[model samples]
Target: MSLSSKVRTLKELPLYLPRRFSAAQRQRNRRNAARPPAQGIVVGLLAQVCGRLVKAGEEALRIPERLPPSAQRVQEELKSRGYPHRVVETEETTRSAEEAARAVGCGVGQIVKSLVFRGRDSGRPILILASGANRVDVAKIGKLAGEPVEKPDAKFVREHTGFAIGGVPPVGHPERLQTYIDEDLMRYGEVWAAGGTPNHVFRLAPNELADMTGGKVAVTK
Candidate 1:
């Protein structure tokens, strides 16, 4: 009989003479018949694993390293004034002068504390950039401001400077402030100042600080 006539279906596909076929040849034919299904399963599993890996990589790439809005404002202000330094965020809080010094790895005196005071009579905002190691004499500040000065509440600081009390930067206030710089800060070559948040800061030369804020240097100890 013809080969096509004998093997009408896939199940019947075998050597033409089954009685003459060796045991090894029959076993090999069975294995070959099973191969397509097994190969398909392995290929499908590999495709799933590869697809999962690709999805994981795409998710990781979507993460961003953008700065906070407050910090970005400070950076823009610095850039506008042709300032060379960039603002940096620290893991530790730089809310206080001592804390800022610790966070920046500098001496307490190298920290510039931006203190906001209100003119008692004019109701205007006065900014004092004092050294961390020094305390502001209200009477001295009042003399420079041409009016009695008093420390204002947090609300006043935020309204006038557009920043919280602890994070007030020397520049970037909503309005131009009558500013005074502590003469003592002139002793340091480089000083740290609050950027725009409690954990943010920037470094600049003491003279650059004076030139940037246009604040008159005087005795504020």
Candidate 2:
């Protein structure tokens, strides 16, 4: 191990490279480090969108939680029957079919105009759940009831149905009346019904309403 031998061995060794990236490679690394990964960015955006959607849904649910007592009862009744539709209360009145359509932003045919009629012979109430756009023929409804039908006054309506003329529903009557359904009402996929008050209404599918009311669908012509 002489000094000259050590010097010759060191001179035969390979040259050393610096422990640093080139200028171009260093610039590329800096660019990559400056921004988040594509996958992480996408996942963060998706999380934000999902959070917004959940918040919107919660707000919608809360908006309908302020229904009036009468409307609340209707809401409860519908939920009890497995219909989870919300009761929407409007500032405008929905007493008439036209008014209801305008207030609900739906067609007149989409409103369920509940009517109470007196059976001339049996003296029992005959409920006709007709389409708002329909003019129910008393003769046709009478034929369905098997007795002459007369439009009952508001007093009779309240006494029999436990609701006012503008807020009558197929159910929630003092006594279950024989109800006839207007076939035209079944045409609409969805219909708006009074929720125990004129200003309160609820969206209901025609089939579900028919089932809930236990009424026979027939042509009211």
Clashes of each: 0, 0
Q: Highest lDDT: which candidate?
A: 1
Clashes of 1: 0
Q: Give the TM-score of candidate 2.
A: 0.67
RMSD to true structure for each model, in Å? 30.2, 27.8
In Å, residue 211's CA in model 1 sits off its true spot by 1.2
The reply for model 1, stretches above 4 Å from the true place, is 1-64
Local lDDT at 129 for model 1: 77
lDDT of each: 0.59, 0.56
What tens-digit string does per-residue lDDT give for candidate 2 at 148-206?
87766677777877776676665666687787777876665555566777766665667
lDDT of 2: 0.56
**True-vs-predicted CA distance for residue 26, candidate 1, Å:** 85
